[model samples]
Target: MIEPETVIICLRAAMLGAGAVCFGAGSAALLLAPPQVASVLRAYLQPVLRGAAGVLAVAALVSLAVQTADASEDWSQAISPSALFMFATTTHAGRTSSARALLAVVSALCILLARGNRIALLRLGSLTAGLFLASFAFSGHAAMHDEPTRTLQEANHIAHVLSGTFWTGALVALFCAAIILLRRPSGDQVEGAELMLRRFSPAGVTAVVIVGLTGALNTWLILGRAPLDRGSIYQLLLAAKIAAVAVMLGLALANRFYFLPRATRPAALVASIAIECALGALVIALVAVFGTLEPV
Candidate 1:
């Protein structure tokens, strides 16, 4: 017997995780252009970025549907094969279910509108990233609660999430893009692949800084104090998240100053990004659980 609250909470957790992936990957794709082009990045880079964003977007919408089903009694009871086949939904459907579903459809349409414009697709993907990032405010412990400075806290929370999403999502997608671009022996393409890694490395470093600073500011507002004073589950999660992110940074630094300058093949780039993705997924899992916990 999954209660509506429990179901909704679970969906919100998955949504936060998936949304982080979307925002991170989409931003990486968008920013890769100017710098990577000069460095002679592989041809398949843009398409892989778009594909990763598309996949992450779909995951987010699926989570939204789960929440919708839980919120709506009609949707909840008959949601198996029959209702889905009939496209039936519940009357108690949440406002966010409707809005997020609409956003998912719109974001999908936006991707189709891009067609084959690598540059446009890259930028458009980043904009869709913005949509999922906003989903955080409408759900979770933050939604519909009363407080002395709720508005200010929500605003700060949004910034914290957006900045972290862009930073984290971009790194995850960049790794995927690397894998797609690096497949097979790249005897001729080695130079371009290496160039892409080198160019994007600095940007990754910068995004880490932004994620940390914005996240710290957001926490100060949300907790009404620094990490030491805040005693909520969310605060504890924040501490863990900071530590995980620190480890991720160490990995990125290793990739940058150690392997990248001389990484001579598409396979090496692909493998390196794969390792990064594994680490990133671990961080996102923490974020998923974090988003579900109470702030106070």
Candidate 2:
């Protein structure tokens, strides 16, 4: 028989993955385009986000199946394997919707930014993201109570999640944009692309800083400021997530300092984009770990 703890762990992982993917994709898609074009791009998100959503959807359904079976029967053997799949599927769907909502609004603001009004887009996106993320924490089991500590932790956690998503999404969008410019080689678009790239760099830097601040805040609230002689699992997980993020930042810095400015070779650019995507996937997976880990 499958262990209850195993099931719980997997369900949490699925939740984290769905949340991160949805939010990240939303931010990146919106950031990649100008206000108007971003609106249109919303309709054409890449299959990775969709596919992940689908998989998580199935997983949620599967979880529901197991829970239902257990509830009706022994509360142990209630949900069959198939039912568990359904649980994961449905849960993933909700998570994906939350993310897509955030992304959609960002895309809407894309049009405004495209018209050379980025401050407007940032303000709009940030405001929208806050509302959506609040909806996010309460949407699940975490909303069961309204205790003060939990309320604060929940808010901080939500901020951490949103900031991470924004950071990763922007990176993905920029990476994709880089690939497009390298392959297409259009003189008319070159200047525009270059300007966008420059704009993206500072944005990336900002995201990294925000990520650090939010993450530190989350840690302080979640784990008290007691020094540990050795690393616990949460610490280990946080370290892994942070390392992954640092590597990604390094790559971005390399691109900005070395490749992007020089208009590096197409081969080099493609390589960097692929690396960015791979690292992003790693970051997403690591984020899943962060969610599951205990604060203490």
lDDT of 2 by residue, 100-134 (tens): 34444453343324333344553454344444444
Worst 10 residues of 1 by lDDT: 36-45
Query: How many angstroms is residue 57 displaced in model 1 relative to the true structure, after the best TM-score fit?
Result: 5.7
Off by over 4 Å in 2: 7-15, 34-45, 59-147, 189-192, 226-231
Q: Which lDDT values do the candidates have, in the order given?
A: 0.58, 0.55
Return the lDDT, model 2, position 112. 28
RMSD in Å for model 1? 5.1
The alpha-carbon deviation from the true structure for residue 163 of candidate 2, after best TM-score superposition, in angstroms, is: 0.9
The C-alpha TM-scores of every prediction are 0.71, 0.66
Cα RMSD of all models vs. native, in order, equals 5.1, 7.3
Tens digits of lDDT, candidate 1, 47-154? 544454455556555655565455445556434554443332443234555566556555545554554445565456457657756766655544544675666556
Task: Pick the lDDT winner.
Answer: 1
TM-score of 1: 0.71
